[model samples]
Target: MLEISISSSLKDAVNDFKIGVIHYQNIVVDTLPPLIGDRLPLYYETIQLSLQEHPVSEVPGVAEWRSIFKKVGTDPSRYRPSQEALLRKIKKDGVPHFVHSAVDLINFFSVQHGIPMGIYDLDHLSEPIQITIGSDQDSYPGLNGRVMHLSGKIVSVDRTGAFGSPIVDSKRTCVTEQTTNALQIVYIRPSMELEEAKQLIQKMAEMFTQVHGGNHEWKLMN
Candidate 1:
């Protein structure tokens, strides 16, 4: 299992800072499972209706993340949180094609819960991860293959360096077809109770294992 800790400075800077980490091992990663695939249309329809009623920025989860981004000196409007970005995409594109089972599962729960979620290929990560704010010099190649500047941003760094964030994740740890061990990180909202975050992760774990065949564990890091 990977150990994660938050920097003291980061803890002092951000209010109600907490993250949910779900670790899975010996998991199968492939196309979306039958149950999820069959439910795509309904999910899309529901999301579209909800989005029509609430602007992306007004969403509770997205709004909280936007505040966090500002605290870290990142402009939420310019570099939107991943959940907001996905919601915008879904509003425009309707139902999306499957990426992979693990990716799809995380994405689904991310939007379902209105939080930003990221999954990394655990084999590629260095142990003893730290969640800290970034400096002007920190950067990494994002999953889109574009270099992302991490200055004044909240970032996750391992021995190898910066690999993940609430807004985006690094390509170095992005999940792949053969990945057997994975880490899913959820940005818990400041207003949400710890128990609520745990329940959300628990539900996600159950669904993921049901689809991907994995043994999992989760912890809250503050």
Candidate 2:
């Protein structure tokens, strides 16, 4: 089993830096078919409905991520949560779509719930996912193949070095076609509750196993 732990520095900073980790086995994380297409109608409709509810800025989860970014000494405006960024684009443009199955599921959940989610290929990660504050000089290749700096940010690193944070996920461990085992993480701020994360994971896990043929287990690890 892989271990995931939080740092004292981060806990001292936010006092509520809680994270949920999930291990998925027998997953098919490839350039998936349009398996998630059936979800598009509902997904787009929900985003449209949400536009009537409130702006992304008024979202509690987005607000929490913004605060977390600030607490970690990063500029919240520059490194916005992936979900928040997607929401803004969708609100201005329209619902976006991805072809990868894992990406499809994760992004769908993010937009549906307005939370940030990251899924890494388990084979690419080192044991003991450590959550710690990043330094000014820390950098890694992003999923898009560009180098991303992790200066003054809260990040999670394995044996391969920093891979993910509230702002962005690294390219080294991004899920791919051959990623059968997945380490999925749903980022929740203190403003968010452990139970909330648990419920979301439970729902996603069910879909993953029943709809996508993956066996999974999950936990709420600080």
lDDT, each prediction: 0.86, 0.78
Whole-structure CA lDDT of model 1: 0.86
How does candidate 2 score on lDDT? 0.78
How well is each residue in 1-222 modelled by candidate 2, as lDDT tens digits? 568889898888888778778889987665434556766756676786777679787787787788788888988787888888878877776676565778877877787777788888888988878888987766898765678788788788887689987667898888888888988787765666678767877887787666558788988766
What lDDT tens digits, residue by residue, belong to model 1 across residues 1-222? Answer: 578899987888786899888899999999886777779778887898878878988988899889998987889988889989888988887754458878877888888888998999999998899889998777999976789899888899999999998888999999989999999888888788888878987888888888889799988877
List candidate 2 stretches off by more than 4 Å. Answer: 30-36
RMSD (Cα, Å) for all candidates, in order, is 1.3, 2.2
Number of clashing residue pairs, candidate 2: 2
* Span of 10 residues, lowest total lDDT, candidate 1: 92-101
Clash pairs, candidate 2, are 30-177, 142-171
Model 2 TM = 0.89
TM-score for all models, in order of appearance: 0.95, 0.89
